[model samples]
Every structure is written in structure tokens, then in C-alpha cells.
Target chain A: MTWETVIGLETHVELATRTKIFCSCTTEFGSPPNTHCCPVCTGMPGALPVLNRRVLEFAVKAGLALNCSITRHSGFDRKNYFYPDLPKAYQISQLYLPIARNGRVDVRTQAGDKTIRIHELHMEEDAGKLAHDPATGLTRVDCNRCGVPLIEIVTQPDFRTAEEVTAYLEALKETLQYLGVSDCKMQEGSLRCDVNLSVRPAGSGELGTRTEMKNLGSFRAVARAIKYEAARQIQLIEGGGRVVQETRRWDEDRNASLPMRVKENAQDYRYFPEPDIPPIRLSEEYLDALRAAQPELAQAKRARYQREYGLPEYDCRMITSHRALARFFEALVELGVPPKQGANWIMGEVLGALSQRAMEPGDMKLTPPTLARLIALVGEGRLNRNTAVKVFEAVFDRDGDVDAYVRAHGLEQVNDDALVREACAEVLAVNPRSAADYRSGKEKAFGFLVGQVMRELKGRANPQRVNAILKELLMQ
Target chain B: MNITPELVERIADLSRLELGQEEVLETAAQLEQIAACMDILNRLDTRGIQPMSHVFPVENVLREDTVLPSQDRAELLACAPASDGETFLVPRAVE
Candidate 1:
């Protein structure tokens, strides 16, 4: 029997604010252990937490981007749990009134474009880091990451296959990057996700007993774990064994998951309103300013790239996938480069060069005006496509002068029609057999003559002009 | 409301409190009395009243997002029960 998987995600994004959520400690990652903590973040007794203003602003902007309605009045809650990573044995979170709610995002899937509904986005404090030493069997607790500002975005169970789950995540990551709130680097732990998945008969209305998988490090791991868990549940059901609700740890090495905590052992984080932190009330004017400051997101730019520049859907998607690449494309357009030509350069030559060197588009130092001048040179027949490509490689990273390189190398095309015709005549006279072959309907002979003609001109001749001149001489 | 033995046992377990049978009974009586005392406020007719999460009528007392120097690491780690100069050492636990 076919089974369907239902999935939802709770994604925690560490805000890119300068300080911690409740304290003034720097939120920088990779500091020495326990070095960035203060009395408030380390949860010293009687040390009260004062909410950071930037954290609230970042959360509101995130809510606006995701189409979530900002909760004008939201308060904090204490999620009580006793873990060594949590110094105070409680996490400051939100439950009664979250920062935002009822948002939706559109993601592209193999099936089609699907919309994932966001349940709520709430601001919270991150817990400390725990590094287990296998040798000593002791866990090292680092409080440096403690109290970092995070927004936990919870999504409705709108995902089906693992593809949709990852698609939604990619779309979400892109959106967050566009929002400029979080770095959204999964490797750096700036963005973390917990998946809640259940399986059921293909047409069943009731969901099977679900399992929680915490922190499947990468997107690939998330997909693999989802597939593995769904199969495990199906096999259990078919074997007359019931699936138990539990938190499972995904072993990336084993390619399977092992149960970590059963229902009975799971800590019930008894939540209550935090009395120390006052409820936040955002005024309409404050929200309007944030809205005004919001940049044009990747999705909107993708649409605009298609509508305004007449770019294809594929081209628009590729160019606007990253903000920097899209900006480059737009700058080229503003500099009088044809939109289609700019799109071509980005998707073809520009992206190709970066990938060849194992670099990101952001690392590219090639300015748009420089590229525009190079393209204009080709349009004016001063430099052919081959010479232009050679010039591009030399100046890609250093942002060296493209025109100077062409001039120094004498790589400019032979634009003089008289010079091209004389070279064609000389090649035909020297290779009469090939010219005879061309006159007798051998097109290969005509190509050979053109090659000779380009050689006679020291390869500076425009290939198109050479071909046209050689074909005329052969017909004669 | 009657506080059942099972409910008392669960609450004691959550708090990690160990108690004898007589102590459990005593704790249950005290908890019931506490609940009853709060029920006194339930008798008041306060319809359409917004529930207050905090006692004080204050909101949005927020601080700017700037990095203030952290307390000296050695000083902070010295207060912990155990530390290895850099991190607090906990008996190896993963959950």
C-alpha cells in the first residue's frame, strides 16, 4: 500500500543583530567558549533580561516578508526544561502571543508550484552549545551561544514529499537572505531546523503517529531522514508493529535514525508568561518605516526580470537566485546593455567563469560597466567573440581593463573590409584545389580557405567576415 | 477540586521531589488549599476583562542592539560548579 508523508518544520534563524536578544553581549559566532556571555545571557540569579530593540525590528521585518501579520502586542514565555545547556533551566520564548502568524510562501516543486502555510513566527533565546568529548565521555558546555536572538518560524504540515520540504526550505533561505536579518548559514548554526513528520495510507484522512527529528544538519540530511523515517513507519505498520511517538536522532553515518526519547521520557516544557520582560507593542508608524526599508525580494525581482526585461523564466530564475547576481544584471541593463544580452552574459559567460574557478557570484570583481564596454566592442566589430572571451578570462577577478588587454594583445578583429577581401584572394590563389573543390560543391573546402585566410591576416580577422569573403571568392 | 494521588505523584516526579506516602498526602492537602484560595477570585463577576500577563502596566522597555564587553571569562567560569578554564564541564549527556 502506498503511503503519504506529512511534514512540518520549526526553523530557528539566528538574527544578524549585533547583540544577544536579552543582553548586550556580542552575537558573534566562533568566539572562544563562554567568552561572549554576560550576567543576563549566562542566567545569573536575579539578573533580569532586557529585550533588544533590534531583535524586535528584525522579527517584524521577517514577518512582513513572509506575509505574516505582525502581532502588535506580544509577550515572552518561559519554556521550562532542565538541560545543562540551559543555565536557567528555562528558555525565553513565545506561545500565548507570537510575533507573527498566518503567513504563506510559494515554493517550486517537481509537481508544480506549491504554497506552504506558516503557522507562527516567534522570537526566542537560543541555548548554549554542548560538545561531547568521546575520549573523556564529558560534554563541554559553552555558554557563548546562549541567549542569541532567534526567530522560530513554525510551518503548517503542508509538505508532502521530501522534495517539497527542501524546496520550501530553499525558498525560505532565499527569503531570509533577502530580508538581511539572518545569515542563514546552516553550517554556522545560524539557521537550524527541526522536522515533524507523519505517514499515513495514501488516501487516509488520519495522520499516523509522528516522530520528531532534531537538527538534521544539512538539507540533504533532512531529505534522507524524511525518506528513511517514512519507510520505517510503513514497515512497522505492515509488520503489525505500532509506531511510537518519540524524538529520534538521525545518524548521518548510519543513514538511519535511532530513538532518543520516548513519550514518557520527553520533557514537558511547562510554558508560562515571563514576568521580567514586558510585552512589546509595535505602533503602526514603526511598522510602516520597516516596510519602507524592506528591499525588493528575490521572488519579486524574478517576476520583474521577466516582465520588464522580457527574460525567460529560466533566465529570470538563474539571474535572480542571488541578490548580487540580479544587481549585476540590472546594472548592465541600466548601462544600455540589451536585457537579453545581459541575461545571456550572466547565465553563460559570467556564471561559467565563476564555476570554472570554484567561486561564488559575489566573489566576482567584474564590473557591469566594464562588461558593457566589452559587449559594445563586439557590437562595433572591434573585437570578435573569441577575442572577447579571452579578454574576459584575464580581467575576471582583478577587474583589469578589458580594452587595454585587447589592445596589448592585438586581439581586436580586422574590421577593414578591403583587408579581409585581399587576404581571401591570396588564400584562394595559393589553394586552387580547395577553391576548385568549393566551386564543385565541397563546403568543407570553403571552410579550409577561410581558415587559411584568417591565418594570412594573423587570426585578427573577424571569422564571419572571413567566411563571407572566402565564399564570394570561391563562387567567382 | 480533589487532588488525586496519581496527579500528585506526577507533579512530584516533574519537580524531582521524593516524598513518603504521608508526605504525599500532606503535599496534596496543601496544593488543594492553594487552588481553593485562587478559586476565591473566580467567584467575582469580571466578564469582558482582559487577562493580565504581567502585574505592572508597562511595555516595550527595550535596549539598543550594541555589543557591550562581556564579563571576564575567568570570573564567570569561576562561579560555575566545574570548569576547564574555557567551558563548563558537564557529565557527558546527550539528548
Candidate 2:
């Protein structure tokens, strides 16, 4: 019997809001433990939580970008659970009425374009971090991340393969990044995903017993977990055993999943509406404002890049993957650089430099104007491509002055006619046989004379000017 | 949604409650009464009534995005059962 895998994702993205969702505490990451906490965020007795306006705006913006219908009436609920990280013992979430629902995102899979439906999106507060000290055998809780705003986007079980899930995730990440809702940094735990997977016969209409895996941190881990879990379930069924519905933890090191809890052991969350905060009722005017505020998403930007800038589809996709890179490209084009040149430089040199230094586009100190200036210098015959590349590296690495570095190193192209003439004269004197051969209609010898002139000028002489000057001197 | 002794025991375990034999019996009886009451409420035929999540008519209750300084570490951690200046210390959690 052929088994087909069915998968859905519940992704939690920490909003980029300046403050916590229900408190005035800063939402900055990597602060000293417990420093960003307040009475409200720490869940102190009698401390009330007031919703942060930015959280709602960001959530609505994300919903709009994802093609979700924003619910006019939504509210928060309390999911009661006992855990060390959750000091309140109840996480404020939305259950009865989520803020948005019925959204769809089109993702490119091996089977071609597939539309994945978003079940709902809700706002929630983040719990604290628990750090276990192996040496001391003690657990410490850091509440600095507590109360950080997050939006949980739940998708329907529309995926059949790992590739589809990954494509959906990538598309979702790009959309959120373009919307500026979240950093979507999986490494930093800014975006977390839990995948629910099951396997059934290929033509089976009903889903098989599903297992939920918590905290598959990276996309690769999600794909691997789905593949491993599906195989395990299929093998079990093939061996005359039934797949148990349970929650499992993906052991990244072991590259397998271990059962955490079964359905019988599942904790009943005992959800109830939170009375501290009122229901959220958004007006049509507010919805319109958010819709207008929505920026060009990655797909729209890709199409625009193709239509307006005449960029290739592949180039458009690569350039628009990161909002920062897309902005950098646009800035360069706006600074009078040709779109294709800007795309080539960014896709080649800029991306190469970032990868070489193990840096993100957001960490790049070289501004777009500075890069545009460098490209302009190269285009105006002031600097050869090689020297311009060196200048770009220096500027990118140290954030140094590009023009100053070029001037200090004398890396400018020697396009001066007199200087080229002098260099050509020296090369001709040194390579008399090559010059004689060039005058005698040996076209290949002309290239040798040009190379000699370039070497005499220490590669500073422009190749085009050198060719022209060498031919003129040889003809004379 | 039948309430059984086993179901009650599971709920107690999840809630981290240790119930004596008599206490479990009494709690089960009381839960049965509550379930009967919920059954009566469920039997009502208010077909068009909208499900309300909150009592108030207000929505979009939000505060401005501003940073307010948190309480001092000493003051806040003082309420904890155990703390070491920087973090709240708890019994070691085993995975």
C-alpha cells in the first residue's frame, strides 16, 4: 500500500513591536536575564495587561498580506497550563475568535504552484526562557522574553510532501519579512514552527492518526522530522501495528523523533475568555488603513521587478527574498545605475561579500548610496572592474570611504590618453617583435602588445584604451 | 462527555492535584452535578443567539507603544520563592 504524507504547520512569529504586547517593557532580545520584565509581563498579582496597539496593526498587516479575512470581532482567551516558564500558569491567547482566518498563500512546489490555506492567525504573549545549568543541576528562568508579542499562523493540512511544507514556509517567511511584521529569524527563535503530520493510503479521503512535533526550529529540521515521522508511521503500519496519536520532540542531534506524550496524556488547556482585556472590534476604516499600509509583498515585487525594471524572474526572486536586499537594489537603480548592473553587482559581489564574512544583509554597513557611488565610478571609466571590486571590498569590510580608499591606493583606471600613449610606447620598445608582427596583419600579436602595456601600467591602464592606443602606436 | 472516575483521576493528574479516595468520590459527585447543569444549559434552543466571548461592547482596547522602566531587580525578585540576583532559580528540570 502506498502511503501519502499529510502535513500542517503552526508557526509562531514574534512581532517586531517596540514593546511587549501587554506591557510597556522593551521587547529587545539578548538583554540581561529578567531585565525587560515588568509587573504586568511577569504576571504579578493584580497586574493587568493592556494590549499594545502596534501588535494589532502588525497582525492585521500580516493577515492582509497573507490574504486572510480580518475578523471584525476577536478577543483573547487564557490557555491554562502548568510549566516553569509560564509564571502566569495561563497563556493569554485567542481561541474562540481569532483575528484573521481563511487566508491562502501560493507556494511553488515540485508539483507546481499550490495554494495553502491559513486556518487562522491569533495574537499571544511569549513565555519566559528556561536555562538548565548542567553543572549546578539547577534551572534558571529568564523572563526577559515574557510577554513579547507573537502571532500564531495556523495552516490547514494541505501539504503532501516535505518540499511543499518548506516552500510554504519560505513563502510565508518572505511575506512576513516584506510586511516588516517579524524578523523571521529561526536561529534567534523569532519564528518557531510546530508541524502536525500523518500518513494514509494514497487515495484515502480520511487523514491518518496524526502526531504533533513541537519546536522544529529550522526548516531543514521540519522537513527531516516530517520525512522521518512519515516513514516511521508507514513502517509501523506495514508491520501490523497502528500509529499512535501523540506529541513528539524532534531530536536534532539524533535526527529522529522521540514520543513526548500520547493523546491520553494530553493536557486539557481549559480555555476561557480573558476578562482583563476586552474584545477587539476593528472598524472598516481601520481595516482599510491597514490594507493601504500594506507594502508590496514579495510576489508583487517580483512581478513589478519584471515589468518595470525588466529584471529576469530568477533575479527578481533572489533580489526580493530579503527586504533589505530589495531596498538596496532599488536605491542603486534610483541613484542612476542601470537596473541590470545593480542586479548583477548585488547578486554577485554584495551577496558574495556577505556570505564570505558570514553576515546578513541587515548587518551590512555599506549603504546603498556608497555602493551606487562605486558603481558609478566604474561606469565612468574612472576605475577598472578589478580595482572597483577591491574598493567595494574595503568599503564593505571597514565601512571606509570608497573614493578615499581608491585615491589612497591609486587603484583608478589609467584612462588618460597621454599616460596610455607613454605606457604603449614603453611596451612597443620592449616588445619590438610583437609590434612588428602586429603591423604585418598578425591580429593576435596586437593582443600581446596590449597585455604588455597593461602589465607596464601595473594593470591600471584601461584595457579598451590600451587596445586603442596599442593599435594606434603600432600603425604609426 | 461522560464523567467517569478514571476521567476524574486523569483531570486531577493533569491539574497536579493529589486526591484521597473519599475526596475523589466527593469531587466526582460534585462534577456530575455540574455536568448535569451544563447539560440543561446545552438543551436550550436559543438558535439565533450569538456566542459572546466578552460581556462588554468595547473592542480595540490598546495602549500606545512606549517603554516604561521595569521594577528594580531586587524588588521584583523578592516575591519569588527562590532567586539569585539575575534569575529566578527553580528545582532542576530534567528533560
Highest lDDT scorer: 2
| TM-score of predicted structure 2 | 0.92
Interface RMSD of each: 1.5, 1.5
Judge candidate 2 at residue A32 and give its lDDT: 85
Clashes of each: 0, 0
Query: lDDT tens digits, residues A203-294, model 2?
Result: 99999999999868899999999999999999999999998878899999999999884445546898999999988889999998888878
Question: Which residue pairs overlap in candidate 1's backbone?
Answer: none
Per-residue lDDT of A334 in model 1: 95
Taking the tens digit of each residue's C-alpha lDDT, what string does model 2 give over B68-90?
A: 88878887888899888898888
Predicted complex 2: DockQ: 0.69
Candidate DockQ values, in order, are 0.69, 0.69
Stretches of model 1 off by over 4 angstroms after superposition: A262-265, A418-439, A445-460, B1-29, B45-47
Interface RMSD of 1: 1.5
- Please list the residue runs of candidate 2 whose C-alpha ends up more than 4 Å from where it truly belongs after superposition: A134-136, A261-264, A398-401, A432-449, A471-476, B1-10, B25-43
